[model samples]
Target: MPIDALVYLSMTVFSLPIAGIRMFKISSLSLSIGMSAIAAAALTACGGSDDGAASTREVALEFVAVAGHTPVQCGTLVSGLGTGSAPAQVKDLRFYISNVALLQANGTETPLTLSANDNWNLTAGANQITLIDLENATGACSNGTPATNAVIRGTVPAGNYVGIKLTMGVPFALNHTLYSDVTTAKPPLDIGAMAWSWQSGRKFTKIELTDPEGATGSWTAKTFAVHLGSTGCVGNPATGETVQCKAPNRMEARLTSFNPDQQKIALDVQALVAGNDVTKNLGGAAGCMSGGTDPECAGVFRAMAIDWKADGTGTGLPIAAGASQTIFRPIAR
Candidate 1:
């Protein structure tokens, strides 16, 4: 029974001796025994007894952005990045994470039940996504909003979790929604800067940096943007057709040594662009946009451990087993 109902019952039983002692003529010893039995039953039903069911506890997975050893912030210059060791100003930094799970010593995976708030975190059926926005609107992050979120809050079964696994992209079902209609759309998905109309999906990652030198080349663009999203998408939901993409471009990270209480996930910008020259864009857009023919995506994909063919027909695919991602790593808090 509910706690309120139990309390009412207990009150009525206790008042019987004073108000209905003559009417019922019940013995004190019998009434005492009945009350004890009722209390025992309620305790068992409420699991106050020794039960083997595991309890769950709230957990917060923190994330941060860095360039080598320097912390990344909007308008702040992070040097020693890219192949040329070029210094660039932070512009934008945001990404989505989903399908979080905690790993046990024996490789058992337990899904982390997300705390949905209709804002940064949302859970629809089997899909749970959280937006990690590290950039505030201040400084060079003028295109972003003032609000920022970097922690993915959820609940996990109470146990010793030694590892963590998560996907760095929004699920396809929630990705193709009408993001432009912010009046009805939910937050995180409603962000205009993360939406891509061309692919009819949201940008999984928006990491942009401004090249200070603006080196002269075929592409003299000052901003080196890395927008990762699904490519070669066929069909449109707006037209009442099912949407699908050839390349999902979702990156999964599995850290076998992560401890949520003592460590944080660090997105190293220097490692992300270490193989490419930040001063210039070799071909296809200002920077890699998850294009098949883009030369700049090779380094980014390699760092993420995603496969990409150089023949211009490359579909962004997850690398083979045993390979690991370099962009996201576990660092001491």
Candidate 2:
């Protein structure tokens, strides 16, 4: 049979007029082809099904801002100064915090790169990392950019991490007096305190003490730097990041050990607010001043707060004797 006759006969058998059936069939097929073409096009635009590589695992570790020298409430400020008892009492309420790490329960720590370090001071609490490099808008802090707290890029293992840790400076072997300079390509390349302090070789942090009697604080302020090693800062004094002058690699620690069963670490920010209990761990204000109180640096460093769930500033209550530091995941997370 001819092709045209076969087409007509088949349409009629299906209980439809030949011409009408033929047009409907063509239109249906055309629509089907059009739909198929669209579907294929959509798939390609969506990065080509099954042709993509492994997905990158990353989590944004955001560091929010809170004033070190005030009560540190979310928006607490006064006379261009932030509200806080201890920091307000001190000459300058700033300390450098860098070399951040995201820890896993498996003893792994992922180090964070320096996002922004404008104005060069590392010790300012609001200086290191935060949501907005929010300024005090009052005094010396006006020109400074609050450090970036959010971890924009970091390699996260495919599991729940328990804690985080990092050395205070660049690794020892890579450090020198020059490394203290944070000039991008400097030897101590990643050292925060050294560069921030400028003069101190590798200061963990600096706290000033004033011995005077007056209505307002006196001008006789004594500067104390927390350097590596012991008094007089003997034995090379850890040029790079870790605890010393001449070491090979960065210090290694397990952040998971801090967490009990995947729980968060909640620090008693209230106690810190009351006045960092410098006496509890470091004996007295005098000892911490010179690292004179031996074997307590770790204790003091441990005393530094890093909670996961608490608000960046905490409840804003004063810390008490019974208050222990709490560490947990941040609520925003």
Structural RMSD, model 1: 8.9
lDDT (tens digit, per residue) of candidate 1 on 1-333: 644445445544333345545534445456667766786687666545344444676889999999877889887778998888877877889999988999999988899998865679888778888999999987778888788999998998677789988888888888887787664346778878888764468999999988654344232568888888988888877777888887888888888899988999999999999888877879898878988878999898888887777775665677752157788888999
Model 1 scores a TM of 0.81
Instruction: Kindly list the per-residue Cα lDDT of model 2 for residues 195-215, writing each as its tens digit.
Output: 423223443333322212223
Output the lDDT of residue 283, model 2: 40
Per-residue lDDT value at 161 in model 1 = 87
Cα misplacement distance, residue 66 of candidate 1 (Å): 0.9
Best by lDDT: 1
Candidate 2: worst-modelled 10 consecutive residues by lDDT = 307-316
lDDT of 1: 0.81
Model 2 alpha-carbon drift over 4 Å, by segment: 1-50, 65-137, 140-152, 157-162, 168-170, 179-200, 206-215, 218-232, 235-287, 294-333
